[model samples]
Target: MPGLGEIIRESQIWKSIFRHPMPLDRRNRIVVMLTNFFLHLHPVSIKKQGIALSYTWCMGGVTFFLFLVETVTGVLLMFYYRPTVEWAYTDIQMLRDVHSLGILREIHRWGAHAMVITVWLHMYRVFLTGSYKPPREFNWVIGVFLLLLTLLLSFTGYLLPWDQLAVWAITVGSNMARATPILGHEGPGQQLLTLGGVDMITNASDARFALLGAREVGEETLNRFYILHCIAIPLAVALLLAIHFWRVRKDGGISGPL
Candidate 1:
């Protein structure tokens, strides 16, 4: 009879899962990467210069890795989190004191900060290397959106703890939205906005109010930020990230001088 290894290799389940043989040769390696959804995001072949640490800096990969880490740890933290004003602070306190889940929160918090730093470094590296030129310009725009999403995610999560620190931080942050030019009521041209003789923009209806879901940051704000951080922003980031990867392949893979 054939060996167990051969039997397993030839099994229908294995074939279905892998769709190709082990990449024992260059051709098979390319075939394997092209056939797999995850690996397919990367090109079948990469130039030495494209991957060289001194050239690319690898900050993009690090930022993406930190994003994934934050997502996983954030989901785990959600199990013990409550977004209500009454329960939010207590829940965080319990996680810190009783449940020993402080480590997970620490990872999420520190990972968020790290993601921000890595993303900026990645953008700076791209700029320094002139990777933003030509076909890579769209990818650079996508990277900018991703950076904004990272910041939004961090901002939304900041209020979940519902502590005095969190409250004051978010209050100050949201207040900054009032100066967002046309979208904000307190911006320069608020007097120009009138609908049927009534002002369309007001403190209660402006950007800050929309962000907080009320005049002040409270239970409603917590709930809104929870939904945004846990669902909406993450979904948008995932979709954009997929496109970002596909575009990298479409743009002839990672850019390098040679």
Candidate 2:
């Protein structure tokens, strides 16, 4: 039998995984990188002095990691939750009372809230460092979209609890949607929805009806929101997130000292 070293060296699968066809110079750069975990974060090494060790509040990557954690925990929480008015609030209590971890939902809930704050802070940090310049501009735009998706995910989630807070907040929010330019009363966008003869500005046909599942916020609204919260929003966030991460790699990573 071949020695252990020979077996690993000759394994076609291992070779494929580790193979790189770069020029010698390019290959050496990659080798030096794969040899260290922390240095792998950069596209190229720089003088340690070049890093603004004191000024860089670089936590955007950390925020993204935390967002992933919240997404995973949120899905797990949904498995044990019901969004119907009758049981929705009770389910939250039950998840806490009877969930396998005893506090799984609590952790997920707070983690979600924390993610919102951290993402905002991450954006603020980038703005402070002037990282929004040049080639990084497009990445910033993508980051903004991810930020909005995070907020949407949070808003959809707030309704799943089906408590007084959830209902009233969604009611206020849907009204704000109705007030939007194309869709709201204030904009030219409302004209198309009037059905030529019938009026849409009226509550009967306005955007609020579909969103609230009735003329006013109630049970069915909560149910529809539950599906959106657990499935639709999560999927959108995932796709945008993949783009967000890919942009980081394409943009040459966090802006470093000149």
Candidate 3:
């Protein structure tokens, strides 16, 4: 005569998947937290002030939420986008003007912008609260790398639209790599790098060349950026983010008072 909820909880399928009973008691709650993947990221206990809205501003959580939104919307956008020069711009136009889910692109765009801002704000908050001190210092460094990755994600995504502004902005941005000291042909120490008395660094072999995969930004540039935006950079970010969160839990949860 057990209830439906109880019957379901007792089923073999449920137990196999969950591996633990309902967290109705303290022991069960701890066991659940230890066993579950997502729940394991959080500490068993957190300071009251650590979670207070006024203290943390919840920027970190918001940044992570926006990243999730970007992932979903970006995936949806990929369905309608073609990275080739011929179809790239046209595909973007169709998404913006012709497709039923055109708004998905807009959402992804704004979410990227928001994620950048929130990550900066989150870093600022951590600095202001002295959260970057001591045992949390390593995690702070991780956060700094995360901030760079966030900006890289934005930069890589900017070109997917294939608009004039996007192309020009990337052109200007990528040009900065030409001044990369020893690695760039136009950089400071290029003349010093010689192989058998021949200058090794040139327009054809430099940091910018590596980035664009050619001397100029064209089909290859678009393809490279598309891969970075859709795959390589996201994978790196995801791996770093996993470490960042795990370090947070290990560093004694969120930063409390000094």
Clashes of each: 0, 0, 0
Stretches > 4 Å off in candidate 1 = 1-7, 100-102, 194-198
lDDT for each of the candidates? 0.89, 0.74, 0.91
The candidate with the higher lDDT, 1 or 3, is 3
Top candidate, metric lDDT: 3
TM values, all candidates:
0.91, 0.76, 0.91
Supply the global lDDT for candidate 2.
0.74
Candidate 3: what lDDT?
0.91
